[model samples]
Target: MANDKHEEIDPRFKIANREALIGVGLALFNFIWWFAFAYGLGSKPVSEYHYILGMPAWFFYSCVIGSVIMIILVTVIVKFFFKEVPLDDEGEESP
Candidate 1:
């Protein structure tokens, strides 16, 4: 018996899937990183407000560094988990 409800997929589905996942993943990572970097909302505010190597609490960039760290973590995760695809000349699939 034919299961007519089943949908057919193109042979190149994996290529599109990887590209889309990576694109969205990178975009999401960048957005989260940027917000974290700009807001500086995480962690406790410095009570001392003293200069740590000539940097004040409000002026210091622990959040920015954390965002960078987040990006690195995402990058590593994507690299480790995602499959690799080779692009053709002009960065388009060769027919």
Candidate 2:
């Protein structure tokens, strides 16, 4: 016997998907920023390298500064764009 029941999808899933995409986008942006700084500045000879706060320019910009930037961005995005949705199934009940 084949049971054919089509239950409507929850609307919260859409919001969740959008938030997930934003996370992926942020990750991609982080990767590009890291790659550009790490390779573009790190390609120079050691003798020609620059220092920032006693750290190599490439490392400082790629790892240290990049992390601070990402923290701020994530904080802003979550605080402004993210929603607080209920995790339980109570909202799915029908009258």
Candidate 3:
């Protein structure tokens, strides 16, 4: 016996998936930025390293500044791109 029944998918899942992808993209970008700066500048010998605000150039840019940039970027992304979806099913009638 084969019974066929199709269930409708919740539209909220699509929105959530899009938001999740955006978050993953941001994380990938953050990792790339950190890796590039950390290795690109830190590859030099300690004697040739430059200091920024009393910290090594690579450490300052890759850790301190990278964190600040990520914070601002996430803030802007959430403020402008993310949608506010209601979590509760408000108007449905119970069976």
Candidate 4:
């Protein structure tokens, strides 16, 4: 069954699948961090504030600094981990 023609996998498909899984992992990381920040520090009283860049520490880290980090990470991921795959049907064989 493994040798069957129908079981053959394209290299491009494998690359695409890998990239998708990595994207999902990054998204999950972001979600967990956001949830922890929103419920953890956000539950505290207002007078407990420590400011960074004129914003509350939690908001600055979660929204501003986190965004910058994510942007850099995503740029590196796309530049190094992803491949350009042809989506055209020109090379496909028709029965």
lDDT of each: 0.56, 0.89, 0.88, 0.78
lDDT of 1 by residue, 1-95 (tens): 23232113332456667668877877786666656544553333666455546765333444545467666877886778666545433543434
- Write the residue-wise lDDT of candidate 4 on 1-95 in tens digits: 63356325556677877999999999988877776766666678989977888898778777777788788989999999889989865676653
Give the runs in model 4 whose Cα sits over 4 Å from its true position: 1-7
Rank by TM-score (best first): 2, 3, 4, 1
Candidate that scores best on lDDT = 2
TM-score for each model: 0.41, 0.85, 0.84, 0.81
Q: Rank the candidates by lDDT, best first.
A: 2, 3, 4, 1
- List candidate 2 stretches off by more than 4 Å: 1-9
Lowest summed-lDDT stretch of 10 residues in model 4?
A: 1-10
**Model 2: which ten-residue window has the lowest total lDDT?**
1-10
Best by TM-score: 2
* Residue pairs in clash, model 2: none
lDDT (0-100) at residue 79 of candidate 2?
Answer: 98
For residue 44, give model 2's deviation from the true position in Å. 0.7
lDDT of 2 at 25: 98
The sequence of per-residue lDDT tens digits that candidate 2 reaches over residues 39-74 is: 999999999999999999999999999999999999
